[model samples]
Target: MDQLEFAYPWAFILLPLPVLVYWFVPAYRSREDAIKVPFFTEILRALNETPKVAAGLLSPKHWQRGMLILSWMLIVSALAKPSILGEVQTREDFGRDVLMLVDLSGSMDEADFTTADGSTLTRLNAAKNVLKTFIAKRSGDRFGLILFGDAAFIQTPFTADQQVWLSLLEEAQTGMAGQSTHLGDAIGLGIKVFEQNPQPSEQQVMIVLTDGNDTGSFVEPVDAAKIAAARGIKIYTIAMGDPTHVGEQPMDMEVVQRVSQLTQARAFIAIDQAELDKAYQLIDKLEPQQYSSASFRPKITLHYYLIAIVLALHLLIFSWMTLRQMFSRAEVANE
Candidate 1:
């Protein structure tokens, strides 16, 4: 809420002018030119009245004087330029840019992760569920999504619209980018996205969620991490599969660890949904989202409203006086 104020309080000085004139100014008086009328005495006798010469000035009725004074006061108030001081407002500013690399390899289709209700879901779906909550909690953070299997591609560019990013994440299916995990190329693409849309004074972060070791990639995962480190991008890794498994679907914990260590970040192993959520929560703690706000009070003039009131008052008085004169004439005519 805001309070009403006056821009020019000095305008109120004019309110006393009519009073001062009444106090000191002489009363208006004018003398008629004396031209002798030969039949003036006869005319006076015909009207059955005797005439006297000396007279005083007649003044307005009390109500008429009051209305004039009120109108003058309103005009002065309008000249004062009444206004209101508006309230303060705030806004959010981003402090971090987080790009997520999710693995879409065939191994991610395994339904081994358990939920709170004792139901099992695929590694990718469990990740998405945890990510939904994670994104919701992270306000004022820019997000980018990269999905990789045999090759790497950007699913969504860096954006502040978390809902749009989540919707795009929902569209990701296992093996859509082909079966083998290409973690290195995904990291490379993440770095490129960060470079392409660089935000000044913002911390860049990369989160890798994968299920298996990289079977082959154009660039090695360690080499990509080194590039990320050189550009000051922190890489957080989460291995979201069974590390004990051997053969084609074996999880490479060392690669995930090395990538995190190279970028001065952390690594986690999430065998179930709970640990997966914990990983994201810890990430949230490490790179917290922050907001900055600005506030101001706007001034809006209200002089026009006061002027309108004055006009309406004058019209009302004019209408009443006109009706009074009309009825008085009608009465005289009837008599």
Candidate 2:
């Protein structure tokens, strides 16, 4: 619960004004009206026989005066600006901005990776499952996703919302961008994203996952890594297939290792789902989200209720006075 406070406590000084007015000021004198009615003799008789009730300290009007005084006090209470303040809450300032660069080239569809239960899954699927868990566990850390095939695209911008990041990741389809891998362009894109949201060098990191080497990229992988290193961005490269496989598409572990080394980061080789999971776990341990936060308090006002009560009382008094006047006029017309 928050503590009660007032912004203008000095407004309480006027609370006793109504009471002082009632004590010192004289009551309004009721004038006796003189009117002659030739046809209505009962009018004269009624006027003469009516009791002369003086409105004084013990008059019935004292109740109205008391209500007026109370209404005034409430108005003063509203003016005093009563409020409640919430307790201070601290929020962490994320110290890390990790950009995940995923390869969406056609080769990612390879089902060489198998789960512990002996079920085979595409390389992308295995990576997605493990990365989902990894992203969710990183508290106080901002993450961004970049998908690349023949070209690179920012699937999701830097966000602290894990759900949004995962949603974007899950929506990605293999080779949606193109059939070839543009590894260097993806790294270059990551660097641009980091430059736009510049943070501390120690806090910036990029994780690149690809099964095949660069096929068609405008920038060279090594050159991109050099730029990233100069900008204080650490690059962790993961080669996700067997290096010995001979085909049109092949994993280049040496190039990946060189890129990682150039950026002062380590490289990992994951031939199966298990190794990929282990590599991510090691990365999580090494980075370990770090942050600093500041504390703050919130406030809520309570003077509105008092002001409403005062308005209600004023409306009641006005309505009563209007009815009394209407009845008095009827009596006069009848007489």
Best candidate, TM-score = 2
- TM-score, one value per model: 0.62, 0.65
Error of 2 at 188 (Å): 3.1
> How high a TM-score does candidate 1 get?
0.62
Span of 10 residues, lowest total lDDT, candidate 2: 50-59
Worst 10 residues of 1 by lDDT: 241-250
Most accurate candidate by lDDT:
1
- Report the error of model 1 at residue 112, Å: 0.5
Tell me model 1's lDDT, rounded to 2 decimals.
Answer: 0.88
Question: Over the stretch 223-288, how does candidate 2's per-residue lDDT look in tens digits?
Answer: 999999999899998888786661136666778888999988889988888999999999998888
TM-score of candidate 2 against the unseen true structure: 0.65
Cα error of candidate 2 at position 77, Å: 2.0
